[model samples]
Target: MSSADSTDAPIYAGLVEEQGDVLAEVRRVAEEVLRDADRAIDFGGVRSSAAYR
Candidate 1:
């Protein structure tokens, strides 16, 4: 089973949470990713030069 599958599973996130410093750093990184995703430009439908569609 995966870490998130059950509480008995060995989870890296659990280890991080047990350590305050690592968990805080992880939270900071996650927040930055969320912020970047919010501000990100959507070029999804745009065709690239090499892509013929």
Candidate 2:
């Protein structure tokens, strides 16, 4: 049988579910860093003039 059809599919699915928490944490960290960077660029006038167009 294919890997997807094997009995281990349930175990693999559980493993994937367990990763959701890590994924959420990673997303939160990335968003916080990006928000800080955006604020700096917005207030520091570091963006390119062409971006205003």
Question: Candidates' TM-scores?
Answer: 0.39, 0.43
Clashes of each: 0, 0
- For residues 1-53, what per-residue lDDT tens digits would candidate 2 score against the true structure? 88668988787678779766566689999999999998776744545665787
Candidate 1 has which clashing residue pairs, if any?
none
For model 1 the TM-score comes to 0.39
| Model 1: worst 10 consecutive residues (lDDT sum) | 41-50
Top-scoring candidate (lDDT): 2
Candidate 1 regions exceeding 4 Å error are 1-20, 41-53
Candidate topping TM-score? 2
In terms of lDDT, the poorest run of 10 residues in model 2 is: 41-50
In candidate 2, list every pair of residues with a backbone clash.
none
Residue range 1-53, candidate 1, lDDT tens digits: 77557775447556756865675788999999988997796566465733865
